[model samples]
Target: MLQVRVSTFSAKQLVFSNIDNEFIQLAHPRLWMQRICKRVGLPILSPHALRHTFATLLFSKDVNIKFVSILLGHSSAAFTIDVYADVY
Candidate 1:
């Protein structure tokens, strides 16, 4: 099992924000990623893809399925296993 130390952040803090420290519109990051992918000649990817990649990477490292399920806010470990059975 992988041991992780989790930290809590302020509820008022925004993970993604504009240069002015204001809330970013929902489409802003997607548009930015699209432009970056176009400039770099890479396939366009969505934010959800990063999330799946994160979970996959964690599973690849032998992290417990229950831990990952909790991190993903899944209702149960079985669901996580079902979704990522190929990873393990």
Candidate 2:
């Protein structure tokens, strides 16, 4: 949440505004992911995987699925459950 706030609001005044995207660009995230994967020698992953991790962690904590779904901006809790039945 803080990250989102910083990216959306505080980022506007930050000096590192040279990048094309305001907050985060797909290229940077992709390159960063690639660099990490190379350093760790793990399978490739996209930034979206972080969202899945968040949902799984929330579900493991027994947070309400509906709330989690909403937090994820998912269309519906049922959709979230379908994707994370293991966590459920």
lDDT, candidate 2, 1-84, per-residue tens: 323323445524542333443555547777787899989989888667877888888988889989998988789989988888
Model 1: residues with Cα > 4 Å off, grouped in runs: 1-12, 17-24
Full-model lDDT, candidate 1: 0.81
Summarize candidate 1's per-residue lDDT along 1-88 as a digit string, tens digits.
8543332364555556754456878998888888988999999997778789999999889898899999888999999889888886
In candidate 1, how many clashes are counted? 0
- Who wins the TM-score comparison? 1
Clashing pairs in 2: none
Model 2 lDDT, full chain set: 0.75
TM-score of 1: 0.68
